[model samples]
Target: MSCKYIYSHVVRLLNESDTICIEFEDAMFGRPKSIRLLREDIVRFMEIREIGARQILVYMGHLYKELKKKDKADYFSFLDPGNIPTCPIGTDDRDLSQHIADQLEAVCRDSICLIPYNTGYHWILTIVNEDKNMIHLLNSTSNRNRDDTWKTIVTNGVKMYNASKGISKGPGFKILTGNLKQSGSVECGYCVMRYMKEIVDCDDPQLEKMFAGCIKNQYYTQCQYDEVRSEWSEFVYSYVGA
Candidate 1:
């Protein structure tokens, strides 16, 4: 369906005062997940506002379901931002490592894991490729320092996953900071979502090329942002109905 048609349905729902809820079965987790978006949450898409984790989570869940339906989700998995352990390397790093490793264990070898990491103030994407043993950090903003903590956590998690599979080598980490920057601070979440969609939509061989082809100091166009917003609106309408 066209984005306009889908967005119109969502706008109509927002006009009503009642709570809007979307419930769908999550094939990856073997359970039903319900997402409730209040009117304010829905408004985030309509306006140029900072999207909450709930909105990202909803979109991720929807994307996972859509991919699974088409049998394209076998080589992909998504980690919830809230489930990722925070920084500072606390005393529970081992437990946290194990928790993250457990999640990666479900992912098959030679697969891509999309993670929307929250750096307290902004959202960025961390793409883990087990095939190449590489972690590509895609941030919409120019803040390389903010990614240090997440890089450590995810690298450790990947190490643990390798250990569990009897592999002794660690993964290589690279921070890609040139292109795909958001124009403003509030667009981080939206950019991350669009990045995920782009990566998932690409073929395996084209993945490396896509990252390597990123131009320096480039920003996402308004059309790209609108595309994400449209997709989000369409997903909500498809699941929630009019």
Candidate 2:
């Protein structure tokens, strides 16, 4: 988890993964001018590898934070465990374990948390709003009903936290609705990063407007998604270069 290790790993991944390299290039310098460009051509040259560079960008603290203008204590960002060796979210057959409970407690300690959530195939964000005692699901697909498992996880975690603190009464957790949502199927990760920006910017009125617009659109576009990713990628590149 050291910065040096993360920096080196990200650089290697970007250079080795062709699709991500192209995406990083596109984000840094717009699309190629040549009309002859095609997916086949990129595939032939791409150094095919697993796509975890972006995840590394997210977990390694490469993303920038403008601390001069905002309170650092308000937001807590943690990278979620999604791959092998990590236990799956609890289900009827499986109960919530101590390790997962500890993770939840850490997230809930912050006023707002930005953590990744995996749905076996796709990735999404689960935002914990400690102030409101609510868990907001910023899903890209506009599927509200899909957050039941997460809700259970948060609820159980809160209970365990209160017990550990020896508090008989405490604020309970609830799922927040009607917040900003992603527009595309694959844009959830991007939306999560953007949410991190919104939390730090502290522009209440503008944030409200942004959420209202997303609610009206029912979903945003890949363009918006790419824009957020571009910002984060820039931060990652700068950190690596530095």
Candidate 3:
């Protein structure tokens, strides 16, 4: 594929059909620090959608660094088919995330779900019909397999932030793990658009400027595109089957 790009007016695809969707902004460089909250967001989004059982978060842009041959894979973080993904560790974190993502893939197998890499940023594929218990299945073996404990599968959102922007922009993508952001959180995307209308968003200008100055890549656009395609298919399938 030539890698299609998104147009200007893209929006989250939300509606009737088979799935629920969620989005997370990156810190320019992908980071896994938001794992707990990202999980919370997924869990909360599913519960609110009343589809907790079926939904799952897809952590994109997992940066696993290359490890030395002497590096022992003894740690839970180390066992990752990917790596722990330090700004230096991401290559290793990549291997770790893939393993977890695969387990997640296997857990949701036969059911409908998608885990894709776009800009190395995190995106989730949630199936509305599935239940919270189903979501639990992916992690069921974690406690048992302590050595290979599966945490959430986080990949890179996009390298656009890291490659194109200067190093000072940093290695992580902007995290909007909540309705609001931390005082110093990098601002970008809808958050900035919302702030521009001056609609009581937040007083912090730091985030607003960050979001305002950020650039988006084809991968994030692709994720949204695929979501729309999936939703449209489900919608048409509903009427056509009738």
Candidate 4:
């Protein structure tokens, strides 16, 4: 399918939700950037399929705006997708745990939970299958030394699950870390969105197609990444300034 066709279809689906009503606008500064599918744009793309993802971004954006009004230093953290908290494994941070649980409970009515995390420089995604008692991690770059983050998410997931559903001891979810294809360093963010896309596009909750599709094909070069970033940067500047 043509890029225009896919984007139009996505926009149609997103508009149906009554929560999203995005429009295409040309950039006024530097050079006009073309709208194309890039790793960076997939969150907006996947948001078309998953209302929870869009709601998360909207809530985070609103939180940042409120914090910014209060002159908070960490306000920008809520705006960036690559700003996952780096609390180590077994950290006893109840506020953070409760906040995560609240975020999940607000959107996640089903058993599955989708999480997007960033380690300052790279982006990774986590999918918790509550029914299957499994946690799968999708990292576009190296998957080494991720045990801490994985464990931290799992630990918090248990807390969130319990709080959201009034459960006692949570089921132990098996952790599975895997690799996704990346064409450039900055593509981690895009890879994270693609991970979400694959999961949403699947027919089965096991997401067999997502696992196979990600491993087989998914990549964006430096130039493509740059174009996407520029386009988004310009759009944000215009939208926020307006």
Candidate 5:
């Protein structure tokens, strides 16, 4: 995927679940010279060095880290497709990924680390430092689980994310849900149709069943669809006998 798509999907998924996943592209044993060289830069910069040394170190570190990140291709494996965190703009890695899944769960528990995963091994890891108070507070949020506020926030957030399009997906926008087929035409465009399906024990019937049940006689005259014949053609091509 292009970097832009990867980044956008990352933002969407994060806002959706407030959780992150990572994946790796290779086996745990494959170490390239370039990855080693970049990691050296991170080691050198851990403590203060001279100004000139700092500048060179930072630049080289950034270049090397970026190369190592892409090289790991293994990191993208654990995430659901199109939904993985981008390693920080400049980052390097070492042992944090040895048990990537477990470490990410730690990041989830201790820090809000955006992690990458490997079905098998980690390619690299970028650690993010968030406010310690927030971590402590989120950890303490459960006082017998009565406060449903967090769940509401997460649910509404996911809803908006699904409905949105360009840049944060705000007002005047329409949600397009290709996977959901509605019980009735009015409910079809609402986009919450996926959840509605679960309520009905299935909101998604075959496309033909949905259309046959939902379309009213006046639907043929509606301005929104604008191409009744074409719609029918697509529907027939996808389902029903030729």
Candidate 6:
């Protein structure tokens, strides 16, 4: 009957089956907002496996909505990672470019945007502060040079958004690397998720300092990863019911 017990039960069911475990209306990308996750998708959080796009999208979607409900996301926006392709090709490239532009235009000029970007091999957190025109890349793997592709994708999107709004060209967003904890091979996705949670939990004034000073080059403890796993399981269980 307790929440912890229910979360454990749901996680057990997720590991045991691969059927659709939960469905929710995700309006993160506007129309066609429905999202369905299979048991395997949810189980990734319950295990030590590399999480896929589904897990990132679903978990962030939940966080975004919760922040909105509490009116705590006024100065920030969370983008759906699915809309931004890792290696966009041909017409897909053009479509995704426009999608990013549209999503950017919806947020205010001086606000921050939290983007969860996945390189084919790992997930990294990209924070765009439009006010300062800076892009902060948080890579848990200590590979600072790994964000070149993401820089290209977002730079193009920002240009397209500016052009559509008839704004003059300016020097684009400056990219900087944050000194975040180094993650293991399979922990990148969870690390990104934890980054977002902590970032949003900070007050507006402390946002810059938290990334700049508080979190140094340290690794997440087992208890920290377990905390994320527990939160993720509870989030899924809310939709799955008893």
User: Against the true structure, whose TM-score is highest?
Assistant: 1
- lDDT value for model 1: 0.73
lDDT of 1 by residue, 172-217 (tens): 9987654477877799988988888887777662445676755666
Report how far residue 94 has shifted in candidate 2, in Å: 6.5
TM-score of each: 0.84, 0.59, 0.19, 0.51, 0.15, 0.79
Per-prediction tally of clashes: 0, 2, 64, 1, 16, 0
Candidates 1 and 6 compared: the better one by lDDT is 1
Pick the winner on TM-score between candidates 2 and 6: 6
Worst 10 residues of 6 by lDDT: 170-179
Root-mean-square deviation of every model: 3.1, 10.5, 19.1, 13.5, 23.7, 3.8
Among these predictions, the greatest lDDT belongs to 1
Give residue 145's error in model 2 in angstroms. 5.3
The best-first sequence of candidates by lDDT reads 1, 6, 4, 2, 5, 3
> By lDDT, is 2 or 5 better?
2
Give the poorly placed runs of model 5, Cα more than 4 Å off.
Answer: 1-147, 165-242
- Of 5 and 6, the candidate ahead on TM-score is 6
- Higher TM-score: candidate 2 or 3? 2
Mind giving the per-residue lDDT tens digits that candidate 4 earns over 1-242?
23343345445543333232322211111122222233334334333322223323333333334434565422122212322365554455565555555555544434456666654445566666645245566677655465565456556755675655666655554334333568644456655544554454344547443454334344545454343334333333333212
**Local distance difference test scores for all models:** 0.73, 0.45, 0.24, 0.45, 0.24, 0.66
Candidate 5 lDDT:
0.24
Residue by residue across 1-242, what tens digits does model 5's lDDT show?
A: 22233234334433432322112222221221111112222222222121122222222222223335556322211111112322232233222222333322322322222212111111111122222111001111112132133222222322333233222432121111222232332321111212221122322323223223222222212222222223222322221121
